[model samples]
Target: MTQQETHAQEAERRGSFSSRRVFILAAIGSAVGLGNIWRFPYVAYDNGGGAFMIPYLIALLTAGIPFLFLDYALGHRFRGSAPLSFARLRRGTEGLGWWQVGICFMIAIYYAAVIAWALRYTLFSVTEAWGDDAAGFFTGEFLQVSDPGVTAEIVPGVLVPLLIVWAAVVVVMVAGVQKGIGAVSVVFIPLLVITFGALVVRSLFLPGAADGLDALFTPDWGALAEPGVWGAAFGQIFFSLSIGFGIMITYSSYVHRDTDMTGSGLVVGFANSGFELLAGIGVFAALGFMAQAEGVAVDEVAQSGVGLAFIGFPAIISEAPWGAFIGVCFFASLVIAGLTSLVSVIEVVISAVRDKFELGRAQAAALVSIPAAVLSVLLFSSTSGLHVLDILDHFINQFGILLVAVVSMVVLAWVLKVLPLLQNHLNRNGSFRLGALWRILVSVVAPLALTYVLLDGLWNDVRTRYEDYPGWMLGVFGWGAAGLVIVFGFVAARLPWRKDTPMDVTDDEEVQA
Candidate 1:
């Protein structure tokens, strides 16, 4: 066979997104996860209230979108998963890709548990089943909280829903890129927006909603002067947009070569932010009603994370008119959002394995998903799962995602000296042209801001153990877990690639029409 024929065959072997629109939908699905609903409102309220938007928008433009463009350039130009893409960039950088895959693995194990909780709560929302003691029911009845240590004993409630989540994920993944990931994204993202939007509208009409808005939006202009607030803004954008975790790199790899990536990045960045803004409105509105019903200040009732979703929202559902409907919309949104994001996280590992082993889609999906499903069920379905998850989530985001992001950006921009090449690649078919400004952000501004956030979190964790968990518990799950991903990264990098794997882009294959 001619050389061109071989290249064509290889390209076909690696699937592409059916079109640019599907790619955008899938990217948005990955970006808009549980964080938008639960985390963003509190981050904004704590940072500077209404004034926080200044730093948040600045961070988005200066760091978030620029880093996104970088991911797209690498994936699209290299036409490979994280490992293959980095290997193609420069042979030594493959470890960075595997490091990202390891982070995704750590994330998937615990992330599914949260989705499972949301799934159960979606049904529980119907009857206000917690019966006024929302927190008690979540910790005692539902999870049956045990002491903070690993145990083999499982919570039947958690186990069942978690099993369902993993089963759904396995099926989607085995279906391949467009048929599975792309199709799910197209359907679920719109449903999430519509359902969540209806919830938001209902929230705004609640009696204390204006009070909640007042509390959330009342900007302390002075917060703008604080270094920590700005740091928080950058941190939120980094985590919210899913930039550092190899998700965008893997997703962008599936798009057609001629796609307008920069323009798409803008759409995604803005869309994710728009959803977060809507979330802030909906969440605080509900909190306002909760506070009023309890005869307390909004701050007294405000919460985030698992507390906000499982404990706090359940209480709201118990009291409000049309309470059952609100609960359904809210928890269903969480399930949909979490599912989309979880699928993307699992796909990163699947794609890396596929590229490295030259496995077919079914083989790679099964190889990655089966073990992941088993591990997820084992670790997160137990009485101690919540404690373990809490530590892993905290440590992984701070040390795993943020640290790698900084290192990769510095290495790509300064060590490998490929920002210019990547910029050229992006601009080739991009609607928006990148220049020195983009380079400055990727190389200088982003790394410095992220480094500050990383060190700040590290120091705080060291000074005070996260949540005052037992020292051994923190040691095992927090620091120990964070350290293991880095170890896995370099170790996996040393493993053999399939002999026939195309590790570098050939000259004729550099730019596809």
Candidate 2:
């Protein structure tokens, strides 16, 4: 092969040895964080009580796994940043690729808004907020204080220490892939898992914990008929798995040809979803027991508020034996889990900047941090940050993940020239082949499924506009659109588009469809 061919091949080999491991753990850590803690138990409280699990699992198998495999195949197949994967996979038609990348990038920025919340909660933990005196503590000192407190007021003796714990994540990324992300994931992912496992063991031992577990596992088949239930299941699957976000594709770009992407994708997906299930077990069992003792069913705590985490969980912990200790475990797990996700989000911004602007590693790192920190402080300073985060999350999940899944399935399954890189690599290694059934899934069924998700999202928007949710929703929708456009503009600007740009076209490759 010529030198050019060799260099192209060499570029195809991205990521350090630890990159794949870091990618899997980091992705799983992002998926398993706030969803398992805040979202699942509350939604489950109302949606089916114990009955939602059936649909959630069905949605997972049908939608989540298929899309997970599809992204793994496409991201590693192209060996480029997400937008590049979509554009490069098929050469000339890069619009959809830009769209996917744009959506992912936007979500990444807004997700920092959520990480800001975790930072706030972590600060609260260090004070006496989770102690048996939590109610008095939160009501008097924590909640009542409006302006940002000193490290001492915010978290007492440990306030500065907690923020540093959160900020050290930025340091990890500053060190780059081989050293920073890999080192953290190796330690933190294991710590997260162990912490979750500890929570589960203690949760099961709680009185009436079995009742909540039964609620999570048992199914009311009648609830399956509710369109909203399916929507919740699908939404949860999309958000909780972190699917359709370009992070998977972006991370996959770092994979070496020798890496087992299918295996790795499964490991990450199952690890994430499994943690989610365990998290449900922990949270619901506690919620159920606590609710029973309080004489209200789980639905009593379903409101989305600052109290959701700060007041709600701490209240439960305060009522329990050695409650302060349990509260410590929960927040500890949250801090590590939050940082793992935080690093990935920051990396998304940094990766896009570096890829598009030809930035050095450190410059790209600082660029992501400065803006993220400023925006986070601005947003959280308002009472509305919590509500805004929820709204942005819904919009991002609905439009971003669903639509990317749609485009990705089409490009990889139909537009791409050959079997996706993972299949090719497996065959190259004489390791494993997906065979005809899996082939059909990658090429056709998966894409079709995403198309349904995509169309449903469009229809949801149209339907909602006619139905007219609150006026505040209009701002959310408007910002969501503007966000996608802004991110895509960044990506599109970076593409080598000459005025006479036929450069968009890559070499001719066969499209299977």
All models, RMSD in angstroms: 1.8, 5.3
Q: For model 1, how does the per-residue alpha-carbon lDDT over 110-194 read when each residue is reduced to its tens digit? A: 9999999999999999988899799999999999889888999899999999999999998999898999999999999999999
lDDT of each: 0.92, 0.60
List the candidate 1 regions with Cα displacement exceeding 4 Å: 1-4, 506-513
Q: Give per-residue lDDT, candidate 2, residue 174.
A: 77
Question: Which residue pairs come into collision in candidate 1?
Answer: none
Worst 10 residues of 2 by lDDT: 500-509
Give the lowest summed-lDDT range of ten residues in model 1: 504-513
Top candidate, metric TM-score:
1
Q: What lDDT does model 2 reach?
A: 0.60
Q: Against the true structure, candidate 1 has what lDDT?
A: 0.92
Clashing pairs in 2: 50-215
